[model samples]
Target: MKLARRLQAIKPSATLALNARAKALAASGKDVVVLAAGEPDFDTPEFVKQAAIEALRTGFTKYTATAGMPELREAVCRKLEKDNGLKYAPEQVVVTAGGKQSLYNCFQALLDEGDEVIIFAPYWVSYPDMVHLAGGTPVIVPTREEDGYAPDPAAIKKALTPRTRAIILNSPANPTGAVYSRATLEGIADAVRGHDCFIVTDDMYEKLLYTGEPFLNLGNVAPDLVPRLLVSNGLSKSYAMTGWRLGYAAGPKALISGMQLVQDQSTSNASSITQKAALAALNGPTDTITAMVNEYRERRDLFVAGLNAIPGIRCRLPEGAFYAMADVRGLLGKTYKGKPLTDSLQLSEALLNDFLVAAVPGDPFGAPGYIRMSFVTSREVLQKGLTRLRDFVAALG
Candidate 1:
């Protein structure tokens, strides 16, 4: 059996790979503290779970419309209007397996061979692979830690070429947790407004903010670009519904229809019960989300403080999301139990093997001297993990 060239070009998700390795280690009786996977540690809220249970009991097991159930689409529209300040007709929204599929649909529907998509580093690991799978080129624009890892509009403009077709924006970003300010988003929006390009905003973490900064939904911030903008979101992160496999998006009717056609040919629709649960999640009381955010905020503060207290580690206080990307360059070339720490991967392995702490290496995110630690665990686990990290680094010195 032979695989297609495109299929062969794809790489496994580094986060999941690390997580699997950590889990295997733990199963072997070695205690492992995993901070690599991105899913929230909380259980899915009771209301959302109950909705799915009710759907199952009611025999709501039939196929839904490829675009989504009308009620769910309407609920999504209401969510956009209420939370994102964007009004969308139900026809313009489509729910898929998850935000990953929504984004894959966008790339599949929009890109042609040789089209270029600008992705900022340290981007989510799947973006470039998805672009390649869609026959598009991924042009990576690197941002610095000193800049809060925010991509400058000017730099993005400089990277644009005649073949540039799209730009991806992920705020409360993965791996780095760098939230774009309203001004920054506006500048980028303004830069690409008249250009013959589309913008795909991944607002998966829109509700996970901690810094009290107003989230500027790019689609709402620049309505003129709505026809070309695709906003992808899901229930995985905020609602702690990773196993539900529900995600959605709103865009121009034409694009949504194209995506619907793709979904019809491919996934057909998200799970019927999952859609019901997602509908409940969107329409039910949002107080659980508020409570989760509050707890995450406290955890973020505690984790950031702990990371900063360690020698040779400098972590930026993340503005949103649940990650702490700490620069470990100060520890490079230092010896850890007679083994030299060379880069992020080596540091990660040393931490896991020596201190039983597991984190994802930044090399996968295009930054090699940093490591991403998720703070979505309990305060007790966070404190112990930080203590292990501190002791490990101190031993290195």
Candidate 2:
């Protein structure tokens, strides 16, 4: 059967592929330790879960407006204003199935054929594919680790062309765990403010920051460009409600409306119960954020330090997020178990099959010679995983 050609542009998620491989191995009675998860290991807060139960008991399971429930949208507005310093009306918000959907809706609504979208390398695996699926070309601008993964404004300017339609900014970024400082965000904002394009800020991991500073959104730092910015976030990461599939976006009324119309035709209004639960999560005690952030900070330190201690692996200390991107280039170009470990993909396969450790390789993320490991697991599990990783390196020679 012939499939739509658009589907051909979108690459299958590498994170999901490795995670599923690990799960399959474990299912087949192999002891696999998976560090590939993008979701938090923590369960949703009890209060949030109780809110969903209450909604169910009240028989509030009907289809909501294609955008979302009124209360949920208003709650999102409040959360944005309070946390991000980005003010918006409830009408400017659109809730969707998940943060992934919110981003997809934006791309579908805005991108024209051959439009260009700028992305950072070592980006989240989905950003490039989402742009391609929307018929837009992904222009990836690689960031240097020496600069702590902060993208340079000069480099961004060089990548811009008249075809540039938008840029996707992921702070406390995936794979690299790099947080874009307010100064850095403003620099890029200033660089592109005159462009006839938009910026889609993915702030999904904002609340998981381990840095000793408050989270900063690009929209908040550069208020002048707010009219052209779309802020996308979800209940999944911050609230530990990934399975609930609730996410939202806020932007200019026109863009939000366009996204809503796209949703109206696709999957209208994320699950009704999930919206209610998300509302509870936004309004309930944010003390949960502090607790979870604290635990993740501990795990991040342990994993980064352990990786750095290994003879061949070099790791960067992430200021925010629960991931550690380790430079495994030293282990490449060598033989592992009589097989050539020429690249990250082959290195990852060796790690999983021979060493029982699973990780997402860097090639799919546009940064070869590296591997991304989530410290989202507990300290005990993280210790064991790091030990296995270290031992695997030691035995590689």
Root-mean-square deviation per candidate:
1.3, 1.0
Best by TM-score: 2
**Against the true structure, what is each candidate's TM-score?**
0.97, 0.98
Residues 349-394 of candidate 2 have per-residue lDDT tens digits of 8889888899989999988999999988888888889889878887
lDDT tens digits, residues 339-378, model 1? 7888989999989888989998999888889999999888
Instruction: Mark the regions of model 1 whose C-alpha exceeds 4 Å error after superposition.
Output: none
Off by over 4 Å in 2: none
Q: For candidate 2, what is the total of clashing residue pairs?
A: 0
RMSD of 1: 1.3
> Backbone clashes in each candidate structure, one number apiece?
0, 0
State the TM-score for model 2.
0.98
